[model samples]
Target: MEFMLDLAVSVVSLLVVGFYTWSLRGHFYSPKMATGAKLISAVVIATTLFFLYLAWYEHQVAWVQIVGLVIEICAAALFWWAVSASRKARLRFAFDPDHPDSIVTTGPYRYLRHPFYTSYLMFWSGWAIASSSTWAVVPVIAFVIIYVSAALGEEKKFSKSPLAPEYEAYRRKTGFLIPRFDQR
Candidate 1:
């Protein structure tokens, strides 16, 4: 059962990466941004591979792995939803410095201003928790900083755009990473 859970964790991690990559199809990014994105993607994939190694060779508690698996599943679903919703919006690479052409408020975007970053953090946090080692936290913290910086950069761009008024309204209704339950 434990082995099965570990395998599932790895499988889901890979599937999420595929989903993310598919979402980038046909989107043009600057050379520098593309390079940065590829580097970040490689690092994230390497981290998942490391977790897979630990799961298969090292001892991890079954229940903790189960919890992490559940979180991973949630992250995957959220990411898919965000991707689907933003498909028409032409998603941009992180730290692109380009103004958004549209404001997406449907699907996961309705609840979170940065659903992609939220899902990314959830996946990283899930894998770290699944590892069931205090050392796993180092990567999680690093990812948190990276995603937060990207999200803040995007937010700053939005604030400076002509859509600032519209974005400000959406920002108030949506949470940064968590959903605002009282946002009616």
Candidate 2:
């Protein structure tokens, strides 16, 4: 019974995220340039399923689970920050071969070149931790690897567009996921 419930929850969550991602796809990818996007979608679904399995069958919940949940919350906050920042820049996902007219540099982007990816990673990591299964960590690591690869692939595509130089400059200044503090 619990397994069934978990499966249903996982499916519903995936559907919601899938639809949301599909809608945003137009803003980020060009026509016929969806291969990378599709790959990312697959990774997300697979990783979600992996986490669900672990949550259902693996380890006991512990204090660390709470820590993981907290981390997940922080990740959600970061995701919101990215979305809001993107909106402020008036940039929609190009979803085309061409880059958007504006390259965002404010808000979370000021700290990380890819806040959206970072947020997604954080969310996934938190979810894994919250599952409190020893195996849950595997999916989290896999998701990170896949996401990074996909991000780099997308970056390669974007590099040829007008926004390339600007993005490169931003990348040089910001960490990909971690924020840098001036120790000096």
lDDT tens digits by residue: candidate 1, 12-57: 8778767767655544344356555666677687777777777788
Error of 1 at 77 (Å): 0.9
Clashes of 2: 11
Candidate with best lDDT: 1
Judging by TM-score against the true structure, name the best candidate. 1
Question: For each candidate, what is the lDDT?
Answer: 0.81, 0.64
lDDT of 2 by residue, 3-100 (tens): 54444445544543554475465334344545655666676778777776666676535565566656666776776677777764544332334455
Q: Judged by lDDT against the true structure, how good is candidate 2?
A: 0.64
Clashes of each: 0, 11
Which window of ten consecutive residues has the lowest lDDT sum in model 1?
Answer: 23-32
Q: What's the CA RMSD of model 1 in angstroms?
A: 2.0
Candidate 1 is scored at a TM of: 0.91
TM for candidate 2 is 0.72
